[model samples]
Target: MPLITLQNVDYGVGGPLLLDDAQLSIEAGERIALIGRNGAGKSTLLKLIAGELQPDDGEVRREGGVRVARLEQEVPQQAHGQVFDVVAGGLGELGAWLAEHHRLSHAQPLDEAALAAVHARIDQANGWDAQRWVEETLTRLELDGEAAFAGLSGGMKRRVLLARALVSRPDVLLLDEPTNHLDVPSIEWLEGFLKRWAAPGGATALVFVTHDRRFLRALATRIVEIDRGALSSWPGDWDNYLRRREERLHAEAQENARFDRLLAQEEVWIRQGIKARRTRDEGRVRRLKAMRAERAARREQVGNVRMAFADAEQSGRKVIEARAVGFAYPGQPQVVRDFSTVVMRGDRVGLIGANGSGKTTLLRLLLGELAPTSGEVRRGTQLQIAYFDQLRATLREDWNALENVAEGRDFVEVGGRQKHAIGYLQDFLFTPERARAPITRLSGGERNRLLLAKLFAQPSNLLVMDEPTNDLDVETLELLEDLLADYPGTLLLVSHDRDFLDRVVTSTLVMEGEGRVGEYVGGYSDWLRQAAPAAYGASSAARESAPREPAPKPAASPRRKLSYKDARELERLPARIEALEAEVAALTEQMSDPDFYQRGGDAVQAHGAQLARAQAELEAAYARWMELESQGS
Candidate 1:
C-alpha cells in the first residue's frame, strides 16, 4: 500500500479549482519531483499531502501510523534560537520538553529545578530517541547544534530546516524548491543526503518541487506534474520525461485541433438558422451544446514567455579589463584579491561561489561601480550596460508592473521596435490585468518575469545579471538561456543554477574562498571536472587560506617541439605531481584508519573522490612530464 494517496481531490479558493479531482499516490522509496509552472498548484498539492490543507471534496488518505514531514520553500524569519531547539520543534509535545531542558540546562544561572522537571518529562515521554535523532540529523546535515539559527546563511538555514524535517524520520518527505538559494556544492550535498535517506526499491519516499533542473535530474526517480488543474505522473528520469511529455503534448494538440474542426463545422451548421433548425436532430443539437460547454471549460496550457533583448550598438572589443584588482571593506577581510581578467565583447562569464562569497563584490569591481582598494579596473568605450540585480532592487514594488516597465511612456522600445507597454508585458506572459496590478501582488516567479521584461527593454552592449534564475520556472529559464546563447554582448552572470550555468555560460569565475577566485573555460560542470584536482584545498578547511588564488592552470599548445607553454607546464608538473602524491598518501592513511569508516557514507565517498582526483591528477601530471621530457630530447 502507498504511504499517502489522494483520491479524486478537488481544491481551490474563490477562483478556478487549482486541483480538479486530482489523484496521486506516493509509494515507498519513490523520489517524486512535483513540477509545474508558477501558480500551477504544486505547493498546494504538497500542502494537501502534508495535511496542512484539506480538499474541498475527496479523500487524502494516509496509512494509519505513517508519518509525513515537509521542508517549506521559504525559511522562517521568526525561527530564532539554538539550531538544536528549533530542530527539536519538529517533534510535538515531547520536543517542547527537550527544548526546555536544553534551555534550562544551558542558562547562565543554571535553573536546576526547572531543568530537573523538564528532564523528568523527557524521560517519562521516552524522548531520548528523539534527542539522539536530532543530534544525528544535525550532524548529517552539517549543522552546528549550538549555533544561532538566525545567524546562518540562506543556504545553511535551508539545510537546518531539512535537518529538522529529517529528524522525524518520516515515511514521506516533501521539499519545495529546496535548492532555491543553495550553491552548487550545497545542492550536491543535499542530493546525496536525499538519495541516502531513501532507497530506490521502496524504503522511504521523497516528493519535492524544484526549479533547479540539475537538482531535479539528480534526485527525482519519478515526476508528478500539475497542468491545467490536473495531475499527471511520468515514470522516468528528466530526459525521458521531457521526450514523453513532448509527445503527449503533441498528441493532445492534434486531438484538440480535430475537436475544434468538428466544433467549427457544427457552429456553421447551426448558423443556417431556419433551414438547419427544421432538419436538426435533437441528439445532434445536444452534442453541439456539449461541445461548446467542453470548449469553454477546457483550460489551455499556459503560454511560454517570449523574451527578447532590446538592440544596442556593439561595445568596444574589450568590454572590461581588471589589472591586479583587489578590494576590501574597512576592518574586514579582503573580498577580492588580486583578480585580473579581460572581459571581451560577446564573452559570457558565469560567477559562482558559496553563498557568502564575494561574487557581487567582484561584479561591482569589474563594472567599476566600486573603486578597488588596490589595483585598476578599466572599461572600454561606448559601454551601454543593462544590469539585472538579483535583489530586484531596481523594481518599483509600490508601483504597478506596467508603470514599472514603461514609467511615464505609453510605449516601450524593444529590439528597435515600438510596442505598447501592456502588449509587451503580455509577451512575457503577463496579462493586461496582471500588468496593471501592483508588483507586490505578483508571485516570486511573476515578479522575476516582470523584472526580465523590464531588463530586456533596455538597450545594452553588456548585460550583468546576478542570481537571475532564482524563482524562475524551467521554461522561462530555458528561454533565457536561449536568449543569452544568441546574445551578442558581454555577459556576466552570477547564478547557482548549475544546469543554467552549463547551458549558457562560455566561461566561469569561481570564488574558491578567502577572496581567491579561479577562472575556468566552461561552466559549472566544467568547473567540477577542472577543479577535480582540488585546486581550492585538500579539504574544506584548507580552502580558506589567504593567498591570491593561483592563476588558471596552464595548458600547452600543440607544437612539434617544446614551446614556451610546454616549458611552463613542465615547470609546474613536479610540484603538481608531488602535491597529488601527498594527497593520495594522506587519503590512503585516513581510509586505513579504523575510525574513518565510522564517519558514515559521506566521509567515505568524499575520501574516495579525493583519492580518485589525486590519482587522476597524478596520472595527467606524469603524462605531461614525460611528453615535455621527450620534447626536450
Candidate 2:
C-alpha cells in the first residue's frame, strides 16, 4: 500500500520555486534513496512528505493511522532537561500511558491486584528491555560515559537525534543525511538497523537521504534522483544509476552530433539557393524554416557546474616530515603523540579517524599553523600548500564572487602584470551574473565549490584538505576527483567520502587516539582490514604466526571452499612453500661444496632430499591460489 503520496506539489518561499509540481509516492517495504545537489530541495521534499511544510499548489495524502518519524541533522536542545527525558519524548502516547501507570502505582489507596496489573502494563508498554535498548543505542552513538546530550559535539548530537527517531518505532522512517558526521562503524550499524527495520513485516519503510556512497550502495533498493526540481526513479543502486545515466547522456550527445551535421548541410543548401535565385527558392525558404524548427527541438541545454584545479610546479623530495610530534589543547591532555609520517612527491595520502580524533589538528600541525609542544616540524624547500577547510569561511560575505576571489586587493608585478577577478571566477563555473551575487547569498554547495576553485587556482604543490566533500555537489566532487587523480603534487586529504578517497588518494594516514599513526598497505579498504583486528576482531594472542613464502608458477584450476581454520592454513601454505624452497636451495649449494658429507651423517643427506621433495609439493599446492583469485575476480 502507498504510505504517502504527493500530487503536483509546488514548494516555494517567496520569489523562486524550489520544487515545481513534483510528485512522489512511498510504499511499504520500499527503501528509497533521495539524492541531489545541496540546496536542490532534497530536505524540503522530505519536509513536504512529513507534512511540516504546505505545498503552494498541491495535495499530500497519507495512509490513515500511518505514523512517520523524521530525524533532523541539527537536533534541538531543551533547557532544564535530562538526556533520558528528550530521548523518551518521541514515545508520545506510550510515554503518557507509562506515566499514568506510575501515578496509579504510587497511590496509597491502591489495591494489590490493581497495582500488579498496572506494573505489568507498564512493562508491556515499553518494549522488551526498552531501557537497555535505549542505553545501548546512545552508547553506540558515543553519547555515554561522560558525553551527555548537552555536552555532545556536532557529530555526537546527530547520533542522539537518530536514536530518538528510532526509539519511536514509527511506520515510516524519514532520515535526512543520516550518514553525515557519523564514523564508519556508526554508519555500518545504521545501515544494518535500517535494513532490519525495513525488512518484511516490519513497521518502517526507510526513506534515506545520504551522500555516503557505501551507505547508498548497502541500503538503497531503488534510487530516486532529484534533478532540476524533478524526480526520476532508477532500477538499482547508485552504481547502476550512474551507468544508466552515462548511457543516456552518451545517446543524447550522439543525437546532437547527428542533428548538427544535418543542420550544417541544410545551411549550405540555403546559402547556395539564395545566390542562384532558383525556381524552388520559396520551397527552399520553407525547408530552411523546417530545419530551424528541427534544430530548436534537438537543442537541449542542461545546467551543470564545471571545475578544474590549476597546475602546480614541482616541489622538493621531502614535501613534509614530522619527528616526535606531540600536541594537546590548552585544557585537555595530549591527543596526538609521537606521530611521524613522510609525505614525498606524488603521494596521495588519506587521513582517517573517528570524530574528535584529532585528524584535523594533525593536518594543522603538518601545515605549521599549530606548533607541536615537543616535536620538530620539517618541510622541503619551495613547498606550497593549499588548505580546504569544511567551514568554508574563506569567502567574504559582503563581497561578490569575483571580488571574493580577488580578495579585495591588487598588486602589479615589476613588469606591470595584472590579474582580473572575473576571469578567475569564471574558471570555477561562475557566470557574469552569478559572479555579481553577494557571497552571503550563495548556497552552501556553491560556496564550497568556489572555495575549491580558489584553493586550486593558487600556486600550491602540496595540498592539505580537511573534509573537502562536506557540502560539495556530486558534480563538483567528481570534477575534483578527476583533477586530483591526475595531479602530480602531494595530497594529504582528510575526507569521509569513501569513493573520493579511494579514487583520489594512494595511502591513508590514520590518527588513532594516543598519538599513534599506523601505516597500512592499499586504500581505505586495506586500512579497514588492518584496523579491523583491533576494532572488531579478537586479540593478537589468538592470531597465528606468519607462515612461509610461496613459489611463483601457476596456470589455472578450480577452487574449493575452505573452513575458517582451513582458510587460515591456506594463507600460510604459500609462505611455507617459499621457506622450504629456500632451504632446498641452501642444501643444494652445500652439497655441491662437498661440506654436507663431512659435516653430517646419512640422516642429513636423507633429510636434505626429503626437504627438496616437500618443497616441490608445497610449491604445487601454492599454485592453486591463482585459480582461486581468478574465480574471485
Candidate 3:
C-alpha cells in the first residue's frame, strides 16, 4: 500500500477546477518533483498532502499515524526567536511547552514557578525525547541553537526551517520552492542533506515544488505534474520526463484536431435541415449534440510564454573594464576586493557568490553605478544598459501589469517596432483581464514576467540581470536561457541557478568571500569541475585553494599538448578526486555529530581545521583534474 493516497480528488475555489477528479499515490522512499505553472494548484496539492487543506470532494487517505511536515516557500516575517525554540515549535503543543520551559529557564530574573510548571508539562507529555530530537536536528544541520533566527542569513534560515521539519521525524516531507532564497552553496548542502534524509529504508518520502532545475535533476526520482485540473505522473529523470511530456502533448493535439474536424463535419450535416430531421439521422444529431458539449467542456492547454528581446545596438569592443576594483563599507571587511575584469562586446559573464557575498554590488561596480572604494571602473562608450533588478524595484505595486509595463503610454517600442502595451503583455501569457489586475493579484511568476517585459521594452547594448530566474517556471527559464545564449550584446548576470548559469553564461566570476572574486573560463558547472569541493559548501577551503585566474585578457591562447603519460593521469583523476571527496565527506559527517562540539572548543576547532585542509586538497584535485582534461600533448 502507498504511504498516502488521494482518491478522485475534486477541489476548486469557485472558478474553473484547479483539481478535478485527481488521483495520486505517494509511496515511501520516493523523491517526487511536483511541477506546474504558477497558479496551477501545485501549492494547493502540497497542502492537501500535508493535510493542511481538505479536498473539496474526494478522499485523501494517509497510512495510519504517518507523520508529515512541510517547509513553506517564504520565510515567515513574524517568526522571531532563538533557533532552537523555533525548531521546537514544529512539535505542535508539546513543542510549545518545551519552548516555554526553555524561555522561562533563561529569563533574566528566573521565574521559578513558571519554569517549574512548564517543565512539569513537558515531563507529563514525555517531551524530553522531543527536546533531544530538536537538539540533534540543530546539530545535524550545524545551526546555532542560541542564535537569533532573524540574525541569520537567508541560507541559514532555510537550514533552520529544514531542521524544524526534520525534528518532527516525519515520514513524509514537503518542501515548497526550497531553493527560493538559498545561495549556491546552501543549495548544494540541502541537496546532500535531503538525499541522505530520504535514502532507501530511511522511511521517509520527499515531495518538493521547485523551479531550480539543478535541484530537480539532482533529487527527483519521479516527476508529477499538475495541468488543467489533472495529475500526470512521469516516472524517470528530468530529461525522460521532458521527452514523454512532449509526446503526450503532441498526441493530445492530434486528438483535439481530429475531434474538431469531425465536429465541423457534423455541424455542416446538422445544418442540412432535411437530412438532419430524417429518422435515420436522429441518433446522429444526438451524438453531434454530445460532441458539441464535450468540445465546450474541454480545457484548452495554457499557451507558452512568448518572449522577444529588443534588438541591441552595438557597443565598443571593450564593454567594461576594471582596474583592481574594490568596495567595502567603513569598518566592514571587503565585500569585493581587487576585482578586475574586462568584458568585451557580447561576452556573457555570470557572477556567483553566497547571499550576502555581494554579487549585486559587484555588478553595480562593473556597471559604474557605484564608485569602487579603492580602484577605478571604466565604461565603454555608447553603452545603453538595461538592468533587471532582482528586487523588482523597477515595478510599481499600485499599478496593474499593463501599467507596470507601460507607465502611462498605450504603446511601447520593442526592437524599433511599436507594440500596444496590452498586446505585449499578452505575449508574456498575461490575459487582457489579468493585465488589468493589480500587481498584488499577480503571482510570483507573473511578477517576474512583468519585470522581463519591462526590461525588454527598451533597446540596450548591455543587459545586466540579477537573480532573474527566481520564481520562474522551467519552460519560461529555458526560453530566457535561449534568448541570453543568442543575445548579441555584453551580458552581465548574477544568478545562483547552476543550470541557468551553465546553459547561458560563457564565463563566470566566483566570489570566494572576503571580497576576493576569481574569474573562470566557463559556467557554474565548469567552475564546479574546477572547484567542486568548494562549491559543495566549503568556502574556507575553496578560498584557500582557489585558482589564481584573473580577469581574462582577450588574446588567442594555445592549448598545451597532452602526452601519453598525461592521458593516463587524466584517466586516473576521477578515482583520485572521488577518494578525496570521500575523505571530505567523512570529515563533514564526523563534524556533524553532536558530540563533536560537546568535547571541547579546541577539539571542534581542530576538527574544523582538518576538514578545511581536506576540502582544500579536494579543491586542488578537482582543479588539477580540469586542468589535465584541458591539456593536450
Better of 2 and 3 by lDDT: 3
Q: Give the TM-score (vs. native) of candidate 1.
A: 0.83
The local distance difference test score of each candidate is 0.83, 0.68, 0.84
**Model 3 global lDDT (CA atoms, 0 to 1):** 0.84
TM-score of each: 0.83, 0.70, 0.84
Ranking by TM-score: 3, 1, 2
lDDT of candidate model 2 versus the reference = 0.68
lDDT of 1 at 287: 99
- Cα error, residue 600 of model 2, in Å, equals 84
Candidate 1 structure quality by residue, lDDT tens digits, 148-184: 9988888888888888788788999999899888876
Query: Can you tell me which runs of candidate 1 are displaced by over 4 Å?
Result: 273-276, 533-633
Please list all clashing residue pairs in model 2, or write none if there are none. Answer: 337-515, 548-575, 548-576, 549-574, 549-575, 549-578, 550-574
Which tens-of-lDDT digit does each residue in 1-633 have in candidate 3?
467889999999877899999887776766889999878899999999999999889899998999999999888876789998889988989988988887887789999988888888888888899888888888999989899999998889989988988889998999999998788778877887888888533467899999998789878866889999999876536887898789989999999999999999989887777654574567888999999999999999887787777876789999898999889978999988887888999899998888887887888888777989898999998999998988899999989998888889999887668899999999899989999998988888889999999999878889999889988888889999998898878889988888899899999988887678888888876786566445335444334434544656788468877888888888888998899899877876564343443344345446545765787888998888888876754
Per-residue lDDT of model 2, residues 1-633, tens digit only: 467878888887754466777776676666789888766788888888888888889888898998888997545645113445455556665544443454455568977787677567757766436545555655655455223467766665666677677666577888887766666545666666677778533345788777777678877756777765666666434776898778877997898888789879878776775546554468767877897897764424335554445555689988889888899888887978887878889899888777777888888888888999978889888888887877777777777877766666542111123445565566566777888888878866678778876786576788878777765667767877897887778888887676777788888887655667666655666565445435332223212221222436697565556657656756776787678677766654443332332333234335444654766676676666554444441
- Order of candidate numbers by lDDT, starting with the best: 3, 1, 2
